[model samples]
Target: MRSRLALPIALIAAVSVAATACQSSSGKSSSDAAAKDAPKAASSVADYNPQPYDNIKDGGTYTTAGTFDDQGNPFNVNATLTASRVWSWYNADAITYSPTGEVQYNPDYYSDVKVSVEGGHQKVVLTINPKAVFNDGTPIDWTAIEATWKANNGSDKAYSASTTAGYDGITSVEKGVDAKQAVITFKGVDASWSSLFTTFLHPKAATVDNFNQAYVKKAHPEWGAGPYTVGSWDEHSGNITFVRNPKWWGKKGKLDKRVYVNLESAAAVNAFKNGQLDYTSAVDAESLKQIKGLAGTEIRSGGSPFEYSLNFNTKSPILSEKAVRQAIQESVDRPQIAKIQFQGLDYKEPLPGSAVLHSFQKGYQDNVSAVLKYAPDEARKTLDAAGWKPGSDGVRVKDGKKLEVGYTLLGDDALGKATAGALTAMLKQIGVRLVIKKADDADFSKILSERNFDLFLSGNRSMDPFAARYLCDFYCSDHDSNITGSGTPELNKEITATTEIADLDAQNAAVNEVEQKALQEYAFLPLFSGPSTYGVKKGLANVGATIFYSPLPETIGWQK
Candidate 1:
């Protein structure tokens, strides 16, 4: 857990207070309150400083802020902060999955090297200016790549998301024809497998008993690979600094060191405003406005295929019945929730693609108009058909059981809590009782892992249409990981058989058929797809943005 300075209660309270204050500041009559209090229109990514690194002066430090605990060891799978930050300091291929889904950064930015893919397998055959060398002067090669895989899989100490993110996968590793080529094999044909590898390649000297122990812990001089190295890591003071990696093989003379301070957004914002931080992260929309108004600071918003949906705990008495679940979904006012949660900046519905990845399949969006619209009357009828009837208190009852269902959500999850609160209000009119139980991140994950919950809420990181593997994992009973506990035996057989089909069209057809089957069963509710939002420092160059939130430091250079 990366330690974060707690935002004073007064500071946290100020956000809601500021929103309320906007009403009075707008100077509109009470009758026009809704219109006057609306959030400001969001700006496009193109409108900001297009070249974030253009004016960046070399040898200076860059700092960003966000919410995380100090215990977040970048070397451990315990928290994303450690692993994510280490990417800028150390080099590796294991756990270094790029969001571009394949090798090479997204076209939105530039990287000299490109990954060539054939036979549905991606290969790093092409080298980009062999100038790419490790911090200890070891040349980056097929050996380095192989060592990374071996250290993570072959060795005893391996750090990965399954261990860190509370799930496991990466089943096998295989080397390609030469040192310059390699292929990672997965136990199953999961689309995410290719994009989740971020293990770093350590110098041969750092290897310990066949394991890369130096990079496995938070020890430094572990061979700085990016533009910076650990200048200071004062855990007691809650500060970490990275000085320029003189050995950084990039187009040098562009930057010196980058400092990473472990602080929450509030302090980070203040530091950036006071000029202590060159780059900062904006935690919410309000902070974005603050960063934009500060001179020489730029904001960028490109995130994962950010999504959220209500997870119906099928174990609940009321929700166990299909009709009751349908009724709850029908009563949700999606547009209203979108307006409040997304502040009207994002589209209110899922885009034309599978819920797993962020790409459109022609005509997919055209078929979703009816599945998501609000239909209270239909909801009531569905509940009625499911044997639930209104009682004296106007609450629904089935077989002498009241149609009251409890929901568990993350307490610190602002968006989820807001959405659940909205659902609570909406369901009240339909005679359904909803109880919200607050759980910390650990408790929530425990429930999910145990398949325990009346209803759950969460988000997806990608959005590719026909992401058949995702549907199978979430809706197939045979996949023990599916949380809903509602998959049928027949569905599992169909999912497995479809995997063997070789033809692309035939595979897609099979996937769509599976999706329809899952939808009919209400395995999961589809939610809106929205662009990720980020706040960046102005003049930082070559920081290519992708659908996944990983940074491209190799392509980034300071201009000033």
Candidate 2:
């Protein structure tokens, strides 16, 4: 999320790298994506400078950085935000959504939409624009749409689709009246029928062999069908370059070139200061001070979809015990962590309550507050009841084992280190020993994949506004993007049924109920949903910290 990761349609949204460690798309797919008509979060909740195409200059290169390439997979659940953002640049988009939840058909691809429910099964009809074509001159038609659905609908284990969320409900995808139209039929009444196909996969990539192997070492520009195409992918430099696509049928992309350079925190901030980067993250106070008021910079900020939190690994011997995990979670001071995190920034949010929805969003509930409160005495009692008694070193012991867990401290950021110190002190209050391990910021993705740490500070970012559907990713199991060992098969099965409830309010209530049950496990301790703040090289437009506004590839450029 913060560095490089695929942000899914829902984001697969990675918590911005600006948080503690690299956080990524914790939101994948769920049947209940809250509701389209639900109250929207205020625009003030986000602060991206809103500049339309008319306001942007026509020809300037815009550069940013991240860990990208996506292993060549178009929709890997673990894809980084940079990859998804880049994918948007080179792919045909069928839908356009606002920072709030309003949706519209982008006329570049889709011409009409018709909905119906026949014999209790929901069916949708979509017409692709006759003029639309892929970069290779293939007509953008129903076959491309069908290919995306079949690859992801869980029918074929062979295809490496991200998640089977909305796609799994589809019973069939057939050609409508002509090659330009698609007819989609779902198994039953589906609440989130419109949530699928915001973007498309070129039919060629959907083939079993190509779907799995096509994008590994190189990005196939000919398979892309958007404003920009992959120009270069330098493995040695970990840099990717994109140039305006000559084959694009839509309006020309404003920038002549786009690039994502992989850099760690210190170098990235330095790059921003040196004017090498058009956009840089400044989530912590130390980083914020660097670019806050440089002559050419403007601090663009808004409510982040990312939630920074302390995640507990249930597989660790010291943490596997539910009581120990519960007590450790209860003892931490979230507000204190917040105080340390936002020390200099003019940002404050209610301690994050749910992994599903941010506090500013409608249908959000303070689920964590009631379950894990700041109570040291009670946490001590919890340990006492579980046969953990204070010993000679004042650390709790259970059956001759010390009640200690290792925490991976990522990077040299002062705020990150300071919060670790606060965490150590809080654990001491309950007679638990917290061992700290130091690692370079670049080691974040490596450490997470190998499950190297017992305790970690990470964020779960969301890309779409209707996050209720992502509960399956957050709590169902640690199969895909979810790294915290916090799910059970029984709970996952229950969550699937709960998300499919047709009534909006009832489904949200059900989603919350399921999440509360999951949080009771104490795997992920929700800290706070911090601001997605960035330092922008002044004059940059249509890009900054906003929730659901994925820029129309051509619109992100220097202001005129």
Instruction: Give the clash count for each candidate.
Output: 43, 15
Q: Candidate 2 residues 1-560, lDDT tens each?
A: 11113221111122342322111112221211321222224323656677888888888888886645535554654444555666776777677667755676787788898888888888999998888888888889999989888887768877655566768778888988999999999887666555568787888988887776676555777877878888887888878888998877777888989888877666788998998988887756777787888988898777666676777888777888899988988788666666666666554445567876766666778678656666788899999999999989999988898888898887666666788899999999999998988886556656665667799886555656555467766676735545676789998887787656777667777777788888998898877555677888888888787776667888888888
Question: Ten-residue segment with the worst summed lDDT in candidate 2?
Answer: 22-31
What lDDT score is found at residue 46 in candidate 1?
Answer: 20
Give lDDT tens digits, candidate 1, residues 176-277.
Answer: 554444454433344333333333445463254323233333444554455455667665654665566666655443445555665544666777788877
* Model 2 residue-pair collision total: 15
Candidate 2 ranges beyond 4 A from true positions: 1-44, 67-74, 158-161, 207-213, 438-452
Q: Please report how far candidate 2 places residue 113 from its true position, in Å.
A: 2.3
lDDT comparing candidate 2 with the true structure: 0.71
